[model samples]
Target chain A: MTVNVLLLLVIAVTFGAGITLLLERSLTRIVVGTLLVGNAVNLVFLVASGAAGRAPIVDPDDPSPMSDPLPQALVLTAIVITLGVAGFLLAMAYRSQQLQGDDEVQDDIEDTLIMALAERDEASQSWEDDTGGEPDEEGADR
Target chain B: MTTHSAMSFLIPLPVVLSLLGAGICLALGHNARAQRVVGIVTLSVVVAIAAVLLAGAYRDGPQVVHVGGWPARLGIVLVADSLSALLLLTSAIVTLCVLVYSVGQGIVEFGPDTPLSVFYPTFLVLSAGVSNAFLSGDLFNLYVGFEVLLAASYVLITLGGTGPRVRAGSTYVVVSVLSSVVFLVALAGVYAATGTVNMADLSEKLQAVPSDVRTVLQLLLLTAFCIKAAVFPLSAWLPDSYPTAPAPVTAVFAGLLTKVGVYAIIRVQTILFPENHLTTLLLWGAAATMVIGILGAVAQSDIKRMLSFTLISHIGFMIFGIALASHLGLASAIFYTVHHITIQTTLFLVAGLIEIRGGSTALERLGGLAKAAPFLALMFFLPAMNLAGIPPLSGYFGKVGLAEAGIAAGGWLAYLVVAASIVTSLLTLYAIAKTWNRAFWRPPDPETAPPIGDWHPSTPETPQPTGDWPPSRSSPTGTKSGEPWAPTLTAVRQLPAAMVGPTVALVALSTAITLVAGPLFGIASRAATELGERTPYVTAVLEDGSGITR
Candidate 1:
């Protein structure tokens, strides 16, 4: 395969996975998506290092091959780091689900703000909404 | 044979010690007491190593060591110059204080068992990461160092997995991940353009690149760093996220994380891409960060949240020093960074103590603390003054040096910095005053107070749900009593000695820095010179001539 074609395929798959993950509400799916994106980036890096080259190992007996060793080394480090990070992310996701009773992350700030505003509006209307001769003390307390 | 070669071996000692310490911490994970001891002993060793490195740098210029006998271009390199040594030393000192403080606070905050056991190892790993970032010579290695620390930080920040903390942690995680991605993308672009990840090699190669391409590289790198540093438009996540962490975690994050970002910018400017258009961009960003950050501080009613905003604002001052691209400016920035780290952490510790003694961190719920706890008041006051750039304080010296450097840089940009510094300092003072009034000076309202029992004069009546004051046990009638309040004062006069000791020590250290500003500034100036001159760093790594063909 041509280097350009392989590079384009890597990019397409990577972005496809990323977009899929972005649309999902499940934390596990999002983590998987992140992993896919990471792999795609690693692939992009490999291609950038000149894809046509042979492996970087030096063998005097074989003279025709030349692979760029630097990208491979870089990719190795990136892969290890990505694995560690992904593990941590999964652990966090598991913990979050256990604690919050849901797999979907809460947009707590937005939800709280909406709830607060609704409460305030309810509070303002409480005095005017009373149609009876006298409001019950317990009902008026809120 | 050269001084640089001898210096290189000594420089990595601290990092190695920290890593070893981290391993020991993990090994002793089942025993909390042993882990604490190991942590303290390991950090003490780090402090010693930092002192040695500083002395060596002072005596023998910059030192560079290539890992595993590889050449500079192909191998990972570690450089310990004046700038790195200074930062390493600051990290050691601040971490030591926080560790001590945590010994007392951690038990209360995290319950003495499993949580703290996890916390110790992670904290050490974070320290190791900071040490690595300071010492690393390869761009890729720098990236690794950043990730090491950042990953640890994510766990620490979200330590308890509480609802508010998790919500905050998610924002922090997403923003941090996005920033890391930007950094990775920039690194990829730089490697593609230069074909080498070695910083010294890239420095020489980057000059040959087209100006426009270089500009793009600069922006990409700086954007990532600015986000990490919590600069202006990029800093929105900080106030929301930072206040949710435990006190020690927040203090360490406030002191160390953004400084690492600043450190990266300083390193890149001096070593790789000196004299670029990025300085102008940094200048504008610094001004915006200072103004916007302090304005955010003004709007906060929570002590820790307000402190978080000020933390972001002060980062602008550090960036301003670097943006000047002059020796004086960079030196002052270094000085300011060191000073700010100590003062900022101390302030957070005091605020944390206030929260422990008083029920809440909110301004509305806390009051008359100065009367209730004199020692806490004193501890909070000194750092507050220092943070506000009061005369005879280390903060003043740092601000003065930065402003002088700014003027010396000589342009409209310099004027903008001066104005921003003035405005930020004044606003910082205003914010601190607000905290003082609400948290210390004002009387606790009866309706909002935590329930109080057996009211002693020393114990400000913890507020009850009712709008009436709790009756004084000494007074039969519910009227005011004439008995002395001295016993109350005696009872609440001191926090546990362990908590009090670290703050007092930090405050004294800050004061000492101010008193010896001349010698400190001289050292900072030398560090700046060593940084600006990249030849020593490059030569140290490449001098063996065993690796590179060219």
Candidate 2:
């Protein structure tokens, strides 16, 4: 029971810290955060595999507990995938730094402007609806 | 083996052939000629195989193949039903066209950052990934498929290693990785709850789980898939990142990639969780995606960015149909998916041609293209009109079918989405028309015209006339290669037949959708009916009596 509790707590802390880092603007921090989150998820899979004990080799008469090997296999695959992605992330970061000398992701100009326009459109439409489609009257009141 | 047994080979052939093709393409290295020939020939064979698979699936229900002769419960299974086969065929066609188009763009080399050899291999791998995802019968396998494609896309999107491409590439990679993580978390949860990731097994096991737990799992999966599908709030990365890639890369990405996510969503809702517990959530999402996506499109001055936004909007149409969770809704959505893929790809290709001729995709600096290149003008006009749901086009047939489905559904939300559908359609027309009047119809004003210099194609064989245009200014590397707001200096250079021919072929494919809408709709309905039943797929894979187990 204590082991399970400890594992759960470790997963929580790791995932929380990882996600916090990912939300930061620095590209290096983001890459580290991805690694951390990936490890945290691996730990979760470990915990889900039940009480760990031994390698999952079976003997005909063995009566001892064996760790569920499935999650370990899953964790191994996950780790490899994370490594591949981390390499890609590092390459992308290097290229980004080379180009702009910084790792901050800039907001797309068109995206922000379009989103703002959408908000304005929504506000105006509501106003027209509130004024029973009399937009001139609504504008005058404003 | 009899014909029935032989047909199972078709399920994995496309993916395997494409992978083999990628290997050969890679070995060809900088030999651009060999790579193009290999890509075209390999994809053509894949297309033929896909057509056969589609016909076989339609005639004989879903066909299941287990790799290495293993049991469905223990091994990866590839299932070819009407849905996946249809997608496979459509995507194969689009990718082949885009490959030929890229070859025409003098895309043989791009300095040290991106080599032409890398493009074909990566593209083929991406196609293989897409096919794998569509045909996967299990969740973990599906996740693998997503990673394969996402990794290939990372390479393709940042092909030139230019500044904007890198920036956009990073954002794309981050978003995709985050979604993959979400999918992983959901996969863990699903496995913990039910102890299996085989979707057919989950279909049976999920019912036994507590309702609250099942709902949580369902929502988690939906959230992950939604990010990938670029539905609404999660879609900001799409319009930002997609417009940065080379034109052919962008074209194929817009056409086929998101539809893979939608395919997964349909599989999730129908095969794994058929209760429709999330219908209301999906409806609200559909309405928001449509309205917001088109609104974003309206605000974009750049042609590629506008098309990207519109791409997001039309995904809503598919989601809208899926939200209805009815036969007609699913059928119409399938039809729309096919129509949208062809039209969207053609539009992006045309956008590429326009950029080639005019030197920029910005409407502000482009004019007199109608007079300059009337062929390009007609090409743009048809797809734009088709996309806006103009009559006698595939888009119109798709929209009418969807509207009918919505009315048949007959709820306040359905009515609202139907109305939104109409509004978004008109808005799409308005936006496309705005582009047309500015870029094509209007006369070239000197204020917006680019400086006149002796311009030539940017290939080595076509020698650059000595120093008329500054070499630094004329180097075509980045998305904004030319002066940001300037038009081309000379009359448009003659586009290679390789490029224009594919564009014309794709546009005709879009029109061909209308020519065969009746039979196509029939096929879609049959697919829909088969999907709604669900038992055929589930049993073909899982039931011991089916003899699929090794």
Candidate 3:
């Protein structure tokens, strides 16, 4: 029921930067953004575990409370899963670069075609109408 | 008591068996025959396990098992209710058939004798992930299940490392990873708010959180899942990525992946947040998903991309049922989910067959398919109509049930959604008919025409695979000079019997749903009742102490 100001600020900073990087067209940058965002979430889980406390173990010398161990377990699992996904994305990015000379995300063939079709449809009633046949349009897909 | 205990023992077998099967297959990587046998046997056993779990669940309410005999409050518990059990069986059947189809079609990118073919192992892992997700009784485990499947899918989607696939695979991997990050954030929020990630526990505890904070949590969870589900605003990734994969991969993904998201949505909405606070927003999303998705389909010139769009569009119908938040609505949604999974998969499989016979899935590049291969035509025609929700099909029955639920809800938004759904169905029919006309009914394009003026598959002999895939668009053989085109019928390499058999079996399974619609709907409603009421699951997991006490 309590909010930690410092932790909140840190979470906001990291999450904000992650979202910004995520918008880039480069797949590597996107993967970096995903990793940062993942770390920020782990930090959120840390904040959720509450103020730091004595180690959660059997102890006779001290009566300090034990910090919640569940969130720590959750964070560990999250980190491992994020690592595996990051590895896969890196492999894909490397493959992309090797094949196309760059790791930048390419525009979709169908999406570009759909946009062109939309433009032509808008000019359907105009005197300067421009339209093409299926074979030519499909050629544009490649 | 005995039945409950016995059922609990069997609940985790699907996930455990699948993971074990995956490890076995991976070890047998160099041996193709051994890998195939292990993969199919593993899935077959899992199917039997799911069927047994389904019957046990029906006979004796929900079954629960706590891992390592740990207390329900402390450890993960896997639960098998009618809802999860039914989906598990359907998915297992579909996965097996797709595996058979994939092997038959030969997705062996590095030739048949490559030292390491990653296909079977990756597929088994994907099934295990799906099984885990369906049976997970907690939010964190659910997230893990999603990650596992997404990871396996990342490998499957880019199998060949070819230019188009790698490019498409990049977009897909990034988007899916983003969704997983969002899901992780939601898990953090749930743990922070409720202090436990278990669903039955959360169901009781989430109600106590402040309404504003609770709304934030629900919206975060919904956002992550809707992205996975490919809801309207977030759906642009799906059509772009799906069509680029090999055919069998596309078929399996079309069948199972998004439905996992739908299953999550249904679980969370029905169990964790019983009050349905975001009904209006969900209805709006459902309406938009249906309209825009089918609109994209109508605009597509390629068969694979067109089917991908319709896949997104049909997700709307399930969301409509979920948004209604009534017994009948949820039941109809479950029924529709099952129907969509089977039929969409069938359609994609047929699209693969189309690629083999015509050398391309583009409507303009294909024609005279009906004359060329009658069985493949029938395969495509049946699923297309069924998808359009024509009367007498399971799809039609599901839509009617959803519409009835919408009317019963009787709000203007509900009415608008119903109207939108009807419009979407008509648009689906239009798009499908357009594809049929161009791809099957009309004569083969003049340039790629058969040499004997016309030809059929059964005439004397057939031909072979001439690198027709990603069909070679640069060469128009006969059109260059005045030389007539050659007649090449490779069985479409005269449509391979092994591949065609599975596709036909899936199509027949879809028709079988129409025949058995009454009982399936009955089971669906009973499951819905358990879901809507919420006591059966909670009691089985937290209250009844079903887990063995060490």
Task: Looking at model 3, give its docking quality level.
Answer: acceptable
Report the C-alpha lDDT of model 3 over A1-142, residue by residue, as the tens digit. Answer: 5778998999999999998988888878888888888889999999888777877886888888888888999999989988988888888889889988998989997688668868877411111221333333223422
Question: Following a full C-alpha superposition, what root-mean-square deviation does model 1 have from the true structure?
Answer: 8.6
- Model 2 stretches with alpha carbons more than 4 Å out: A1-3, A63-66, A111-142, B1-3, B107-115, B452-492, B544-550
Order the candidates by TM-score, highest first.
3, 2, 1
Model 3 chain B: worst 10 consecutive residues (lDDT sum): B468-477
Query: In model 2, what are the clashing residue pairs, if there are any?
Result: none
Cα misplacement distance, residue B541 of candidate 1 (Å): 2.6
- Candidate 2 local lDDT, residue B359: 60
| Tens digit of per-residue lDDT, candidate 3, span B306-385 | 99999999999999999999999999999999999999999999998887667567765677788778889999999899
Best candidate per lDDT, number? 3
- Candidates by lDDT, descending order: 3, 2, 1
Identify the runs in model 3 with alpha carbons over 4 angstroms from their true place.
Answer: A122-142, B1-3, B107-116, B448-486, B490-492, B546-550
How far out, in Å, is residue B238 in model 1? 1.6
Reference-based TM-score of each model: 0.87, 0.90, 0.91
